[model samples]
Target chain A: MVRFIDGDTRVLVQGITGTQGSFHTRLMLDYGSRVVAGVTPGRGGMVVEGVPVFDTVAGAQDRHEIDASILFIPARFVLDPALEAIDAGLDPVVVITEGVPVRDTMEIVANARLRGTTIIGPNCPGIIKPGEVKMGIMPEQVFRRGNVGIVSRSGTLFYEIASHISRRGLGQSICVGLGGDPVVGLDFIDVLRWFEADDETEAVALIGEIGGDAEERAAGFIAGGGFTKPVAAYIAGRTAVPGKSMGHAGAIVQGDAGTAIGKIEALRDAGVAVGDLPGDVAEALGGLLKG
Target chain B: MKLLEHQAKKIFLDYGIRIPRGELVDSAIKAREVANGLGAVAIKAQLPVGGRGKAGGIQFADSSDDAEMVARGLLGTEIRGVEVKRLLVEEKLDFSDELYLGVVVDRRSRSYMVLASREGGVDIEEVASTTPERIVRHAVDPVFGLRDYHCRRVAGLLGYSGKEMFSLASVIERLYRVAWEMDAELTEINPLALTPEGFVALDARLNIDDNALFRHPDIVEALRLGGSSDLSPREREARDLGLTYVELDGDIGIVGNGAGLTMATLDTVALHGGRPANFLDLGGGASAEMIEAGVSFVMGDSRVKAVFVNILGGITRCDDIARGLVMARSRMGTEKPLVVRLVGTNEEEGRRLLESQGIPTLETMEEAADRVVSFMGGV
Candidate 1:
């Protein structure tokens, strides 16, 4: 019932034997995620940190009941692993690899949507539910079991807010880094929709950066009265260089459309409290929930 | 990853699309020779950025001498911040109508979208804003190839019929294929001129994905040669180290873990009345070597009076960043004031690591920004 993942969710680690995959696999397991198996094409017989390795998601599915799969493959090889997991019926697939080609991501996202699967990120820090499970590469210590549902486009920025929230005794229910790529798996609206239905999530915090119109669309969704949870928003990159992509693929100003001020105004019109800075988010969310 | 016009046209020709016959030359003498060979010619500046025509980077010549003269006038000039080292001498085409055709990555739909517009030789964004209905967009299903019906719908929308419609449809299909095969974020033929012979591409633009450069060796080679000519030396050096760096007009050198955090840091600095010298994202799970490389690059900027290290470690460990700061100081011998803010994932140990080295670490982003701006004596 907790959005996307819970304690009982069995996870399959893609690219399990690789440097990033194996490293985060240990962290996810330590955080109490039910990681059942691992997948590395040529390292089928290998055992990474006591998790059984398979050649493919199909092979991993033979022995364990995997609810979702997390991809840690390199950017160049992300599409194949993602498609393989999707083809094997992995419902909620998470891609953590950065620098995935936009075309390849388009194909993967299109294919995933046609197959009715949820993809989290292509260049994002994954999801973490405190006292339950951690899927991607979020720092576990910053998270504590609480009621705020956190979703963001940036990874480290999410941790900054999460740490601030946790330190102030306002813990998160689930924090999802939807990724910084232009074409991500779950956007602000999608995650917001899930948060609205989850009873455990009392409020939501959306950390959006300058770039695409996803934030503007989220503002529209909130204006439609679809989400009832008190939403606290922070749009980064107010001083971002125009027309230049600030690291992330999705974080760029086209002309006048995807500016921070525009997104902040749109969200404010929808009754969402917007923070002036990253540090102000916790106080903003606290004020919104109290009101 | 925006390709020069000549490079884009080469790809267009490779895909069997007709383009105005052109030759790229650096010298005015060669330009004259080429223009004479082609008869009447147009001298277009070779730059990846837009607005060349409005910026006087394009000119028409009725004779070879005129072409050479125009080329000489433009050869040593800068257009859109790019040096006009090369010019494209192309045969001027006589076209009756101008149309727009492009294949763009539609992020909202999570698909590749092909857009065709009857109105061309103008800003497509203007058309999108003022009259969106003039543009016809068809989201191509990646599973199935670009269907004839899809092309026909776009062609019909552009007001083409019969043989012209079919020809335009084929052009759209080819553009989509080229975009797909080349991993282009945007491949556009603005003002697909309707010459008496057929639809010839008058101007072409192709922006390939930098992340997908592994698949395109030609682009990688081009990038090495001059694809990054727009980037400053510091930015180019950072690129060589596999780091994301954008030079800005500011004094505080800022480096951080993720894009959002990096940008937020920049804003935080600006809020405190201190300008940021550059934008540097060390990325997740960065090593000491990466930190060293990132910090050194930012420090290398002459405009940077101070360095601000902002780390909100998620998968990125702060202790590693501390070691990197230490390593960077040793390697670069920087005397500039360093303000470090470490939080999340081994934050205490990271702070301890910095404190042991006599470097003061701040607790919050606000505190770090305020202290740095104060250290710089305000903007």
Candidate 2:
């Protein structure tokens, strides 16, 4: 199997009756993902696109073997379902819902950690393994099967960089959007570790943005030889400033870290090749893998 | 959203935390009346940003007349580019020590941290840079919260002893309660003055998490009562329209489908020798109508020489963007040049649509950036 999932991986869709949920559910099934069951509280007895819907994660699990779960619930009601999936022993709880409260996210993260399960996003496009398991909202045509492993903070960046590499005749083995929220389940470090151990991934392309020490910490991990694979990086928001609304605490919390320039310098210091723009990623990643 | 100093102090008063006796006033008459009762006061301009003390936003007045004069001088004056319409008139505290106390979310620990230091009333970042050892850090468990032992440990690190130590611990506990209950991203009491009376939060800074506003109806009400005075008219409109638009001093206006891509578009525009007038993200799967609104909003800016629409359409369809581009051009009635870069979903169909409409749609961000920058020289 690819690092996270494969075509045969049994999937569970939370909030399967909703518009976006039903649409992506059909998309995943069409892409050969084994989306066996779905959960939609009151709409349990109904069938969506031939997939049986259950009221609870436990009820869905009782009928079918579920490997992973994707959340498409409303922001106000997302936490309970996310926690239910985690409690039901789902390995990767992919939350596609946006606007989840930071407090709820903190609780979910803490719970996931306690269970030793992986929770991908509170506001993110989920993961995809190209032609294999498209357990995400990303379109399938631009991506093909290849060697580069992609991990990004932003969804569109993931698409742009991956499509750039694919157009250059190289494709991704796995591309993970780690969400655009404050705290996420997996960071650059965790994904890099996965890529280092993944035999399919020859090189890695990383996309970062302003407003966190995630990149700096990833740099530290790479410098310490935590992940031996070649990495090509791009930090968005080079001309970006800390959001004025974010206040002094964000700056005080991170004294000299989290700046785009700071992250670039750190990545450079760690010997990772940093791209100047989105299009430079595929070219730099090609160079990195070759040399 | 960040709370003004007076709002934060009001919350502090609601909790058991001690704060300087103060009231928020917009007029100099009210400031004089408050100062008359308090005798000596600190007329602090209630701005959303920090570093106001050094910027002369905080003024000292020994008498009510001086307070009125200081209030008149501070009101309507801009501090760090934000006009101050209100002031926090408070009784100045006489203190022996000015210690730093703050609670903030620590992404590294995946928990909240209580930061304490003997050094305060200055830049905490400067303190962190110059003498990081002076700052004591304690990670609080989200479930258990800030425990008694944890607070006591912090108080001891700040050089407190016996009853004062316990009192300081209680203060920290109360502050933690405020942070946890209020869904605060940051809670700070810089210069938590250890007066002969007790530990008074001389300056209160509170930033509530924007996402958690759904839970705090009280805070939502407070926010409604206190309009978003910090945002400009355009920015306020952008907020209502669900677009993330940040104004910049440049000639090119950028519109994109996501935050990261939008930011990269800005950087790419700058890299190709283009200056971006603003950062506008239309978000994922933005409809043709939303794009029209976004582009129209940016074109409304007289300083913009050209507009660049960058769409990497994983979920966002390029045809929708192309349709929106034509709509924006027709609706705005502006002659500003446009650059469109489309990739991912429905790329070719959208490009064909734009080409047929006489809008040149480029395939790469680099080429689009180059073309947009060239327009800045003329057209």
Best by lDDT: 1
Candidate 1 residue B177 Cα shift, in angstroms, is 0.7
Cα error, candidate 2, residue A288 (Å) = 3.0
lDDT string, candidate 1, A3-84, tens digits? 3888888999999998888998898989899999999998998999999999988988888898999999989999999999
TM-score of chain B of each: 0.95, 0.95
Query: Can you give the DockQ of every candidate in the order shown?
Result: 0.82, 0.55
Where is model 2 more than 4 Å wrong at Cα? A1-3, A245-256
The fnat scores of all predictions, in order, read: 0.82, 0.59
Docking class of 1: high
For residues A170-226, what per-residue lDDT tens digits would candidate 2 score against the true structure?
999998988877767778888898899889999999898877788999999999999
DockQ class, candidate 2 = medium
